[model samples]
Target: MSVDPVEQWSGVLDRFEADIALAVSGGEPVPWNPPVEAEAGPLPEELADRARRILDAQLESMAMLGKVRNDALAHLDALSAVPDSQSSAGPLFLDVQG
Candidate 1:
């Protein structure tokens, strides 16, 4: 028997939500691979709210990841701007003969 489109759409959302949940649960290995596409076409009115919730969560995750990327890049840039210790003529620390 063929599954109804609405049922298929609901299942897509269910998987999407579960994936998001796994990511949010703070597991380092939980990959963020989302469904390639919903394939259900236009969403039905009944599932609109659920879809909106998923979209909101996705946006938030994107924003959070963007911040993390920017922060890491900034740190990398700062480190790169610093001269290497080997390049300096003097020792990094002053040694007391006493």
Candidate 2:
């Protein structure tokens, strides 16, 4: 028996939702099932709209993660650029008269 298009879309939506939830939970990485345009193209308007919304949320999440990764790398680079304190013969902190 052929699967109903609506049912197929629902299944896809369900998987995406679960994966999104897993991502937010900080759980193990999801084997994300991104929607394929060929399969999604024939979906009914309402279901397609739902899929688009999910895709948008995923895109936002990915952009956020990219920003966070870049920020973390920048911090690491900053720390690495700091000169090693051990190389100096001077005391670690200069006593401020304040």
Candidate 3:
């Protein structure tokens, strides 16, 4: 027997919720799942609407996370580019005057 569309959608939603939680907390990475094509039938309006809302939030969170990660990487690169006297293997000198 074929799987019910509602059940398939519910599974998708459950996985999505877990992924969102992990993403927000910076936990283990969530593997990408292929998109699920809807069967040839209409889903309950309420279910569809709720799923859409969840999807929209997920997309927004993903975007924000990407931006934060990119920003952090950029900052690290900038810090690495700066010249540091400590890098050289030589005697260090410090001058203090009152």
RMSD (CA, Å), each prediction: 4.2, 3.9, 3.4
Cα lDDT computed for each candidate against the true fold: 0.78, 0.79, 0.77
Q: Candidate 2's residue-wise lDDT over 8-86, tens digit each? A: 7788888887777677666687566566767654777778778898999889778877887899999999999988998
Error of 2 at 27 (Å): 2.8
Of the candidates shown, which would achieve the greatest lDDT relative to the real structure?
A: 2
lDDT of 2: 0.79
Q: After superposition, how far is residue 49 of candidate 1 from its true place, in Å?
A: 0.4
Clashes of each: 0, 0, 0
| Model 2: per-residue Cα lDDT at residue 6 | 84
What is the Cα-based TM-score of model 2? 0.65
Worst 10 residues of 3 by lDDT: 35-44
Model 3 backbone overlap count:
0
Q: Which is the better candidate, 1 or 3, if ranked by TM-score?
A: 3
Report the C-alpha lDDT of model 3 over 1-98, residue by residue, as the tens digit. Answer: 88877776677677788888888888897578654455524555657877888889899988999999999999999999976877867657656773
- How far residue 14's Cα lies from its native spot in candidate 3, in Å, is 1.2
Rank ordering of all candidates by lDDT, starting from the highest:
2, 1, 3
**Runs with alpha carbons beyond 4 Å of true place in candidate 2:** 33-41, 83-98
